[model samples]
Target: MGRLRRKLKKTLIETSETGLSLELRLIGQFIIFLVTIMLCISLILVATGVFKAGMKQNIALFEKELSHLSQDIYDDFGNLSLSSVSLA
Candidate 1:
């Protein structure tokens, strides 16, 4: 009867240890998953920032070109008006 009790105690201990080990493994995996997700978020933020900067630069360039074109149009209109007055 004593040997049987000892055997039962050993089995219970082993079962509890197994349960603890499984829980720890699950926790570790969860931590790793969270870290991976954070890294992905950081990467996406960096990429978006770079994209926004590029878009701003492009918009500035476009505005500059539009201003130059508008200036040319205004000058042409002025010349046309002057020529018409001279003719009149």
Candidate 2:
């Protein structure tokens, strides 16, 4: 009867679980947060790479654009070697 009453008291307790288990749980959560931040940074770099590849144009496109702008400036200038930027 004493054993049964003790078991019942244990089941009805308000405070439970050990400190070691709680500390392990907190450490696991902190590690997850760090990993999540790393993954997010990696994703941002990947997105910027894709954005640059599509928007920066190719070597051929850049050269063709430069040739056109230089031709336009030459027609207007008397004999000046002025540099220009072609922004899109």
Candidate 3:
């Protein structure tokens, strides 16, 4: 009976230790997963921010070029009208 009791106690302790170890491993894995997700989100945000800035610069450049083109067209039309009136 004494030997049986000692053996049972030893088995119980090992089982409890295994359970605790599993719980710790699962918690560590969960923490790692959360960190990975956060890192991914941060990287995506940074990439989008850079893209947005580049787009803004491109839009501004295009607007400036378009304004210059329109001014040139208006001046050419005015000159053509004046020349036609003089010839008539």
Best by TM-score: 3
TM-score of 3: 0.45
lDDT of 2 by residue, 1-88 (tens): 9999999877656335333467778999999999999999989989889646755468779989999999988776733433333321
How many clashes does each candidate structure show, in the order listed?
Answer: 0, 0, 0
Candidate 2: stretches off by over 4 Å? 1-20, 50-88
Each prediction's TM-score versus the true structure: 0.44, 0.35, 0.45
lDDT of 3 by residue, 1-88 (tens): 9999999999999978776577788999999999999999989988889647788889999999999999999999999999999999
CA-only RMSD, every prediction:
14.5, 15.7, 14.6
Q: What is the C-alpha lDDT of each candidate?
A: 0.92, 0.76, 0.92
Better of 1 and 2 by lDDT: 1
lDDT by residue for model 1 (1-88), tens = 9999999999999978776677788999999999999999989988888647688779999999999999999999999999999999
Q: Rank the candidates by TM-score, best first.
A: 3, 1, 2
